[model samples]
Target: ARAYRMEWPADMTVFEIDQPQVIEFKATTLAGLGAAPRAELCTVPIDLRQDWPKALLDAGLDRNRPIAWIAEGLFGYLPPAAQDRLLDNVTALSAHGSRLACEAVPDMSQVDHDQAREMMRRVTAKWREHGFDFEFADLGYEGERADVASYLDNLGWRTVGKPMSRLLADNGLAAIPQSNDSVSVADTVYYSATLSK
Candidate 1:
């Protein structure tokens, strides 16, 4: 929303898609602010676990036009099959010049899932002590997911992968501190890609 408010080009439309509950919360919060959202901003409310592409199309997305897609902090939450399905849908909808930027998780098979889950539980409990009520372990899918870079490569997308530490340093930001379950915080990657002609 802030990006749409501050940086979206006038000629381009921006669609923000999320679960219905999240969308409802955002809508209500924006309404309380008493200011109209940008004309180019379209909020599409649908569960990604369902028929989200149809809902997106119904919300005025143009499949024929090129789009820049971002999936920051999202894929990790979905099951491996759901992740693949999302990519399939995006590929189906994308036009020739479509591009994507996403944050990629490391190979879950290489991580200690039990340790990671316990660490997250501890963090969540600490937060709950301060009034936040949410199960952190419920927020992510931990298993052997497909490699995002490999998947995109197989689809003929030109992709570049960078470590999160490099990305942060390039942007002059500090790297994330190491934690007990370093696999959860370390080894994250980022990818930028363009569809093949």
Candidate 2:
């Protein structure tokens, strides 16, 4: 995907990558590679899986340094087991002062397969036509209590959570239409967190 970037002065370092997921990683890697004006760009293979966190650790992602990891719009696409495994992997690999943020989608355990499939049927059908219909399991922390946070805490990281309402309000979005009318609506609520080991 092509994106237009605001140009910076020639002396400023810049990094660009073709994929949305790698943008920050590439930018950080670029800045780390040089003290002078420079840019580094690379495409991570899609076949790369959750092991990336461990790989980054092995590659010496600085634990003493604050790093940002994002799993945007990704949680629901993974099975519950995979979700847990990935988070566990990340927790094990992250260093002190590392911040990880993500939108905690509804865990599949909270969703009925029939309802979820029906609700997402159209998109799934479209993707299947294109030869890729990703199977999904919504999985994350259990509640406002932040299960993910507790899990991370056991791994020696301090944790904080940001709720979805606050995020929407920050971005000037009004309450979703018809959202407040039902207590039973599967909370698509997102829980975000920061952790420092």
Question: Against the true structure, whose TM-score is highest?
Answer: 1
Q: In order, what lDDT does every prediction score?
A: 0.83, 0.51
Tens-place lDDT digits, model 1, residues 1-197: 65436655668778889888997887788788875665477888878878989988998899998889989999888888888889888888899889999988777786677887888899899999999999999988877888898898788688899988888889999988876674745578989989985
Give the least accurate 10-residue stretch of model 2, judged by summed lDDT.
Answer: 136-145
Put down candidate 2 lDDT per residue, 118-165, tens digits, no spaces.
545555667778898574212222222235666656766666655666
TM-score of each: 0.91, 0.57
Give the worst 10-residue stretch by lDDT in candidate 1. 1-10
